[model samples]
Target chain A: MDAVRPVFYVSDGTGITAETIGHSLLTQFSGSRFQTDRLPFVDTPDRARDAANRIRAAGEAARTRPIVVTSCVDGSLTALVAESGALMLDVFAPFIEPLERELGEARQQRVGQAHGIVDFDTYHRRINAMNYALTHDDGISMNYDEADLILVGVSRAGKTPTCVYLALHHGIRAANYPLTPDDLEEERLPAKLRQHRNKLFGLTIDPIRLHQIRQERRANSRYAQLDTCKREVAQAEAMLRREGIEMLSTTHASIEEISSRVLEHLGINREMY
Target chain B: MDAVRPVFYVSDGTGITAETIGHSLLTQFSGSRFQTDRLPFVDTPDRARDAANRIRAAGEAARTRPIVVTSCVDGSLTALVAESGALMLDVFAPFIEPLERELGEARQQRVGQAHGIVDFDTYHRRINAMNYALTHDDGISMNYDEADLILVGVSRAGKTPTCVYLALHHGIRAANYPLTPDDLEEERLPAKLRQHRNKLFGLTIDPIRLHQIRQERRANSRYAQLDTCKREVAQAEAMLRREGIEMLSTTHASIEEISSRVLEHLGINREMY
Candidate 1:
């Protein structure tokens, strides 16, 4: 068994930024197994000490120094955390001075949360996009006219998760319409979907993969049968190709990859939250 | 007028990690306005040059030096991107040496993607949690028995977004049920919820905020009226208190903050992806 190492993300805020960057770094070092935890809202010196103690205890228990990645802006809090028996990676340490020089101003004081809700408009855009996704999910509402991108494919082609990711992460209004057998039987796109041809992005998966996914949902059903899966996927691909919709095979792709391709194909440039 | 500064998160991979940490750092520079864009998948020399030109062009167009935060692993790619007229913040540059010394090994080769799909198990948890969130959204299904957390709250008090965030980020199966007028007036936890009180979390919002949200859905209706909002919020809070359920005010809280509180309260120590 690989050695188990303890890692902590200590942040004065949600610690999400620390964890995200730390995870990326950890991916680079793949030899040892890591058990990770986060000490969030560690703004005050008291909380910082508490976090340090936890890190120290984790190191002691594991018999290896814990690695703590922090995003705290306060120097004193960071200093306190540095005392822990750990390799501390400060997310903001290198960028601060250069940024201060570039902007010609000292960093502003914050109430200690990382996500900057610069305006209610920015916040509302995320929530509104989420609402649109949920309301138009599974073709419950065919408001394709308002959708920024429409995902079209057979059932379980990884549409809903991609829609949710796009909405929550990029503030993009994404709606998904599943292609049933009835729709797949015909060559042309659904009238509503044809209207939004520019917005359509199709997702296809390996029939074997789709079969495995469906098998878990319903055992031995026609939907889970390999023959039915192959037929539906073939028809779906043909229809998508005939209609000139951009298609991607989601068999081995993560939602991040699929969502990225959808946005790139649609020319939708949005910041990922 | 506030001058617009161009910001780029250029990466050999998704650039999501760069963008997230960069946003936190940007929060400190509150005086300047920033327009951010991401150039992902710059793994090759030609792609790196293209990204560099885009960064240089954005700076020229905006009449300001662009600020670039890159999470590139390839030294050559990083060097190419650095030649752009921008303040380059290399995300991994600060910690690489220290990490190498501590880990006693060089970083592994990656396929230019930040997300480390170490195992399909991690991937499945995220998708499974997402399906649970959708199936159980807005009291659509009463599978509280399988839920890791169940959010009980008034509609528009920010339950759905929190559930989605928890599932997507932490792989926690969170389901939400909206407390309607009838449910709030009963003064006891619903029979279904009572059985799983440990998993129940209540969300309440200010009536003014609730009224504003509801008004957008149905203008000038009884549900959107301020009086109805006040009464419903009051009754919901009272019922939560009577049932000994923990409640939170979602009026000013972001989904990140609320999700953190819920996990902390519930002692769910899952890593954030």
Candidate 2:
């Protein structure tokens, strides 16, 4: 069994930024197991001290120094965490000084600004894009005119989640349309989709994976059969190639990967959120 | 106007993780302007050299060392990036050595494992949660039995997006139901929601903000009126208080913040994705 180590994500705010960066880095090490704790809203000096004590306790209990990944912007709070005798990786400390020098501006050292809702315009744009994605999901609404990208795929080919991710993360108005059996039987893109073919991006997956996914949704059904999935995927791939649309396989790609590929293939520049 | 500094997010894979961490760090410096470029799939030494050249060019043009935040796990690739003559903050490099020593094991040094589809169970859970959120959005489906959480809020109070975020990021099965005018007028919890009161959470927002959001959705409608928004918000707050359910205001909260608060308040531990 892999040894378990205590991993702490500490932040003066919600700890999400720390958690995101920490988790991504941790995933690279497949040898060990991590027992994680998130300490959020540790803004005050008292809270910072308390978090440090907790880290010390965790290290003592595990008989190994706990790893702390922190995004605390306050200098004093970050120093307090560093004194906990753990291996501390400060996400902000390494970059802030250089940024200050490069920009010729002092750091604000404001708590929660990194993940807060200070920018209402960007927040609203993300919300609006999400609403757009929901309303236009599965071709329920024909509003492709407003979409920055329209994702098309067979059922369970990862269209909906990718659209939601694009909207939520990049504020991209993404609409997803599922290619139905009827459309696949004809081996042609639907009329409404053809008109917006310029913005069309296709997602394909292995038939076996699609079969397993469908089985989970509806067991012992014709739709969950391997043969059905194979036929549908074949037709979808042909349609994507025939229409000269960029296609990606979701069989081993994360939604983040799919969204990135879609954006890169479309040559869309993402607005900073 | 703030002078723009060139910023680069480089990674061995999609660059989304690097961009996420880099963007969060950069948000701390509100005084400076940034022109960002993302270079993904820089897995090989040759690609790393090319990426370094681009960074050097950006730095030369901007008359400042371009800031490069990278998540490259390969040693040679990271070394090549550090030689770019840019201010590089390697997200993975700073922690990997300590983590390796702590675990008493060597890293596999694999590229793109951090954001890949290697874990099918986790990937499926996220997809399942997303589908659940979509099906149960706005009380469209009353199958709250399987919901880990059910969010109740007025229309445009950011219930849908928050639920989707929780589902996508944490693999939490969240369902959101909109509070209608009729329920608010009655000043009572709906019959269907009464049994699941323990799992219910309320979302409220400032009437002015609600009005602005509604105006964008439907201009010149009674639903977008300030008076109407005020009445609905007041009623919603009172109803939440009467029902003894915890509530959070979404007026100035991001989806990440809202989800974190909801999970924290409900004593829910998120399954790390």
Candidate 3:
């Protein structure tokens, strides 16, 4: 029986979490003596069939008993379990029964929607807006045209982490463009953003704080100087007023509040905790 | 105002999240600038008082508008807000009212109980069991006396992970001892564990899978050979019976299941999830 082996099944979409958890679990049984294999993302029937065949073949070759553990959030989980022909220990199975009982006929359509409630149209729209924000570092033409809301700030004002956090956690499509020296020099909105002036929102902070953050990366560089930070912030704020950009001082707010305030200003739903 | 600075407050515990949120909010201003300072881990009354004094001193020295964004999870959060004497944004403040309304006193107490509960008697018993298991590696006098429960198996039987996981996550002390050729030669419990045998638990697996896991760590070593694994497993089980030790095959079990079964054997509280 020592010649027998074991096989593992991983069928979740984005198999990363499943693989990590499975590895952690298996590492605990060093003395148990088992072999493991992973079959991930079997979303289609043919893929499920292939996985089943592989598991069966591995079992047939085993000299002792066989065990298969599987994880998937989709209905394909049920399909993979049926095909594996080994004892299955399903982690997310308990939630399925309660969901069916609660949703009734709508449960068929609600399969993956337990984790996400927003429609796909809204999801894609937000993703596109965020994509725009990531690419356009300075507020320009697309800032007024596509962004549901625009984030304006001096350099290193934390626009990226906030934008990414909103996108990942709350499905908010947030774009941020920095207010730079040239923009402040002109003291006017960029030509592309002139039409949608009302959609622009600006963030300002204590220059000293901005200086400290800059110093961490550049260490005594011109950009990290306290006097330079003070001057640039003053210029950016004056230019925002001259260009008719509405703004807020980030000196006293939280990310949740800031993101929600932007959403509130734009009349969009705020979904963060 | 240009010469005036801003202050930033950063927390030690949940400050990372607070700073991200605070920065997002600050980016919205089109005009004006300030300074920032970080205040971490002011959860206690004394720390809050110290933070208040520091903020007061910084504000007195600054010429610009002073803003403070804070995040803390204790009653001292409110105390700090009252004492800061600046334009304050308390990030975690919003959570308290909502959680209080949802959980009420009973549920809050229960949550506290879960975190604070430590059965000292059980803890000592488990630690002794682990120490004994480390030395005996088989059912015997010391093993039985020390262990509230004993795990036995061939090499790589996963005793360490299971035992450690129990201790770390659930505060359930566990000790696992391996069965080796020396134990089987005697056809009895190891000399140290000969007295307290009832607490013994044994684990086995499909010998082939055991060989595969062993081969990864020690390729071509006799210990990784299928025949050797099978022989050791058989001998271990035979010795368990000869010495009246109990055993389980871990070839197809998940950690959750293994943990649950162990709890069942020990009459301990099982994890509901």
Highest DockQ against the true fold, candidate = 2
Q: How accurate is candidate 3 locally (lDDT)?
A: 0.54
Candidate 1: docking tier: medium
Error of 2 at B271 (Å): 4.1
**What tier of docking accuracy does candidate 2 attain?**
medium
User: Candidate 2 on B1-273: residue-level lDDT in tens?
Assistant: 544788888998888778877888787778788899888889899999999998998888887778898988887898898788988888776677877887677778888876765568878989999989888997868899999999998999999999899999888889998989998888999899999998999999999999999999999899999999999999999999988999999988888788878887888867445
- Candidate 3 residue lDDT tens string, B1-273: 354445555342324344434443443232435454545444566767777777777777774435666645444454665475766655444433432342231112111111122343433333333334334443333324535566777777756545533543344545676777787677777765555466567777778878976886699999999999988888888888776665666665433345445665555642210
Q: Note the residue pairs that clash in candidate 1.
A: none
Q: What's the residue-level lDDT of B26 in candidate 1? A: 91
User: Candidate 1: where is the Cα deviation over 4 Å?
Assistant: A116-119, B116-119
Best model per TM-score: 1
Please identify model 3 stretches exceeding 4 Å from their true place: A1-113, A116-123, A139-143, A169-173, A242-244, A270-273, B1-273
Candidate 2 error regions (>4 Å): A1-3, A60-63, A82-85, B60-63, B82-84
True-structure RMSD, every candidate: 1.8, 2.1, 24.8
Which of candidates 1 and 3 is the stronger one according to lDDT? 1
Q: What is the CA-based DockQ of model 3?
A: 0.01
lDDT of 1 at A42: 87
TM-score of each: 0.96, 0.94, 0.33
For candidate 2, list the clashing residue pairs, or say none: none
lDDT, candidate 1, A1-273, per-residue tens: 645889998888878888889988888888867999978888899988988898999889888888999888888898999889789899998898999999887887574546622345666788999989988887769978889999999998889889999998889999999999988887779877877889999999999988988887898999999999999999999999988888998887777878877887788889877
